[model samples]
Target: MASVTENKPSNPWQVWRPGIDPAADALERVSVLINRHEHITAGYAFTLGESARRYAEQCSLGFLLGLEMVVREHGNQAAILGWRHAASTVPQPSKSQNEGEKDA
Candidate 1:
């Protein structure tokens, strides 16, 4: 039982949205924001920006955003899981850094 609990994978969806109630009320709100972002960025399909495209694709993978937010909110188990999922997105994170590429 201990091993089973220890092996449970951290999930980003399980992370609570700060200031938002983690209940049925938040789902549609989140979905609306997500859909709005998707619609607004759909024009990117026609744009010829390679770097922007790569950045968007990396964000699409999700772990980086989840990691950054959870890290910013102080800490969470999902943040730890994000690190485990981030090896492929190293160069990606370097670019996403707000301060500098120091962590790169």
Candidate 2:
């Protein structure tokens, strides 16, 4: 007996994942982050057009390290991409973070 899944036509662009693919998930998340910010230039690796989870916006340096780590861990079978444009403005420290500076 053929199951419903067996009858579905496979799309070449769509990857067949058994359960959850963590590598692909991370890749997509990072990719979207870089894609969203027009002025944001950062390294991102992606396995597909979008993320399995999500994309977050944050400081550049931190994001750089994070993206590099994700790519290093999941670069296998991945399409590696990178960019660097120092036009982004650094975010100001939060109130809580600034409070600690006052103590100094």
Residue runs of model 1 more than 4 Å from their true location after superposition = 1-3, 20-28, 32-104
lDDT of 2 by residue, 26-95 (tens): 4555555445544333333332212322221223455546765654454332323321211123355799
- For residues 1-101, what per-residue lDDT tens digits would candidate 1 score against the true structure? 37775688877557645334322222323333334434534233222122222233344446435434433343233323333344444464445575565
Worst 10 residues of 1 by lDDT: 45-54
Model 2 bad stretches (over 4 Å): 1-19, 39-66, 69-104
| Cand. 1 TM to true fold | 0.19
Native-structure RMSD, model 1: 16.4
Model 1 steric clash pairs? none
lDDT winner? 2
Instruction: Work out how many backbone clashes candidate 2 has.
Output: 0
TM-score of each prediction: 0.19, 0.25
